[model samples]
Target: MEPLELVPGRYIGEGQPCFVIAEIGQNHQGDMELAKTLRQAKECGADCVKLQMSSLPHKFNKQALSRPYNSEHAWGETYGDHKKHLEFSRDQLHELQEYATQHDIPLTASAMDIPSLYVLHELNVPFIKVGSGDIHNLPLLRTAAACSKPLVVSTGMSDIAWVSQVYEELTIQDPPTPLVFLQCTSAYPSPPEQTHLRVLDTYAQMFPHAHIGYSGHELGIHVTIAAVARGARVVERHLTLNRTWKGSDHSCSLEPHDLRELIKAIRSVEAALGSPLKAFQPSEEACFMKLGKTLVAARPIRAGQMLEEDDLVAKVAEPRGIPAQRLGSLVGGYLNRDVEQDESIMEADVL
Candidate 1:
């Protein structure tokens, strides 16, 4: 089963570089001036930038909307007010999309409701993301699958049964859409114990045709890299300009320096995961020349004398000589010439 390749020519699979997403979900806080932050993501070496798009009324009921919300991160008295303030207008989204396109960064978004999903379709985004909160919303998933764009869905607060059901729903469509499943731990600043990164393997097993990814809410960048090492083809992490910003995800988000370092380390890790076949490498040549042990004579031996194991010792020879691994075969061979003690033993010396 070949892994799915997303738009912009980014491959996510065993032999491909890990695709990275910089999630800018509501971090702009209703300030379109911060849209330029997408450039920062590209400079930090992210393959894509993601934002959250939703309609407040479409996503929340009356009771949920009117509920009081008081926290250092809250922007309004009620949850709905805060959400509406954070929602981007259609024109705003268009402007951001244009900006992202001009900069050559693939901009994607997670739609919380059917309306937002259609809006993203109208925008013609390279891909659409279904966040964890909407994983159980089969109707939305059905609609998203119908959008015909590549889909990247996150499974966080849902179980395997629910995921399987979603998979069945999506596959039932004619000419099934390409899909990528991201293993996510939904908590803000999720604890390491609850990360459950190994679920990436389970997703690969259950949906062998789809690419598997990780959406990390953990505090540092290492867990995301670890996910890459564990066969996660894509990695998504929240990004913010400043951790002190007043937003629910700010603390867990990677700031500029953190993001730069994370990307560097991720690329390094990918390079280090080289081929599985164990053999000699060009990089090992210098070390081999300096430290590779070779068979050497432990005592002087006259010509025509049969060599013995006790007469040889393995040492770092000045010039390349018979490898110590072939010492067993040399034990009964006759020396062709006299050799001094501690001298390197060459294959030509044996008969």
Candidate 2:
């Protein structure tokens, strides 16, 4: 979410610095072992790390659990067990908050249901994030907005109107409103053709008061970095230690190498963007010496002879001479010295 008033506000959407979120999501794979291992995700260049808050029963049907939505990395045989394994208790979340705070990383998450939202509220999380699945959950959206916490809303599968409605609803609060919309395409490793990056611009125009962002599902670093270059202020991408880790998000998540590369690229893009000034730079000052023209003697000319175009030629290696552009005014001036052929001519050598 790009709303900066939520404590870490300076890093959200446009003109403000980009806030990079490393989404750990369910890659914790229901093992607290993995979550603790990721306390340093921030050191890897993320401003925040995100988790998913969900209840096992609410998230999966009983039948689905028995059948077990089989994924290679899941710990349990069924979907319920898998979610149960992934679920972190309130105490666990509190520990996570402490770890994040201690490390100077913002720990945030997406609320998938009312109970999850209640848990987050109880935890007094810094903000609320709505995922692609909940974009149309008006009641959930209202509940989230009512909390008056900063909101990060993702638009994965919705049309413009659907997103517009969400924006309008969130704004029932006030101006300089505290919400940001992430342009997302809801697919596991979403396709490039489907990534309508142009929506970031449209969203910015439609809700100029809100921060516009990009939540990436692609399998690499290029798209997220490109989004920053195009003016997106918030970038949230799935992240994992290993892409091969089995989970819904693993296939699309950035491994440490890729995530690091993206962070470097985004920062380089910002440095390269610089201020829009068109003036010459320090490194460019050298070019002028090689390319600029300076007046030079075309051939030997006696001191009494008035200078003539044929007597001088413009050439590089200026040697502190008058520039060639001023040669016209010096045409009839007297020669102060007897100049040799092909010698660089100085203004002091003429009247």
Candidate 3:
């Protein structure tokens, strides 16, 4: 698959460096000052910082919104109020976008509903996110596709057949919208057993045109880093200033130090992944000289004697001689000169 031009010059695909997203979803605690976490995300090596956008009234039914939200992480008595507290105003989102621009990092958001989607389109975000909650919303997916921006969709709380249907519908358009399918499990702090990173391979196989990625809600950086090793071209992890903060996601989100370490480890892994070809590497030359074995005389053989397999042995010699692997070619050949027992055998000594 061709690399996706996620932004003008930046891309995500095979052979490209993994694009890391710092998902700062509601960990901001609704404070504008806290939202500056975007700067921290940039400093920690995130390619993009993302927030979740939702027009509460459109995103939830009245009954769902009015439900009691009294958990310890709740900021309000009702679910609606809790969401509203975390939802930034349109103007505030614009300000945050500008702030991200000034900091030289791309800012994007997940559109939780049609209204929020339109708001994000107007904000001209580089890409739009479709969280798992909206994956089953075909109408919204169609609308998002028609908007002509890259859509990063998380496949959580849905089965493969449904994901395949969504992939077909969105990609079959006249000019297929650029798409990235992220394998995700909706559970907060998803267990390693449920992470199912192999889904990345399935997506890569099933949706060859779309870029494959992983959106992790799992604790620590290990699973997410393993996702990159598993061929994920893009990776998203929730970010927080403090995991102890009063929010449901805070418990699963990575703090600044962890985020930095994650990015650093990912880079190191990418470098180590290197090329697939097998050949003698320059880095191994010194070690080879010191420890590599070569063919040596198993017993003294006089000049003009026919050599046999039993006449040669492999040993570490002071001066490099015929490689041990060339032992077969020396068999049945006549020796040009006498050799001492265990003497290094050279190509020129054979006829």
Local accuracy by lDDT, each model: 0.88, 0.81, 0.92
Model 2 CA deviation exceeding 4 Å by range: 1-3, 13-15, 57-68, 71-75, 293-315, 320-351
* Number of the top lDDT candidate: 3
* Candidate 2: 10-residue stretch with minimal lDDT: 1-10
Candidate 2 or 1, higher lDDT? 1
Q: What is the TM-score of each candidate against the true structure?
A: 0.95, 0.83, 0.98
Candidate 1 segments whose C-alpha is farther than 4 A from its true place: 173-175
Give the per-residue lDDT digits (tens) of candidate 3, residues 1-351: 677888657998778999999999999999989998789998999999999999999999999999999899998999999988999989999999999999999999999999999999998999989999999999999999988999999999999999999999998976678999999999998999999998888998899778999999989999999999999999999999889989999999999999999999999999989999988999999999998999999999989998889999999996789989998888888888999998998878888
**RMSD of each predicted structure:** 1.7, 3.9, 1.0
The candidate that wins on TM-score is 3
For residues 139-216, what per-residue lDDT tens digits would candidate 1 score against the true structure? 999899998888999999999998988888887766677888999989999999999888988987888667899999
Candidate 2 per-residue lDDT, tens place, 1-351, comes to 333754454445445567888889888877777886456577678778888898656755778768855667667877677677788987888898888888887787899988889899888888789999999998888898887788899998899998888888888665534887899999998998899899988998898667888999987788888899888888999878777776778889887778888888999887787787787788876887778788888889888898778887888854757788888987888787888887777767776
- Write the number of the candidate with greater lDDT, choosing between 1 and 3: 3
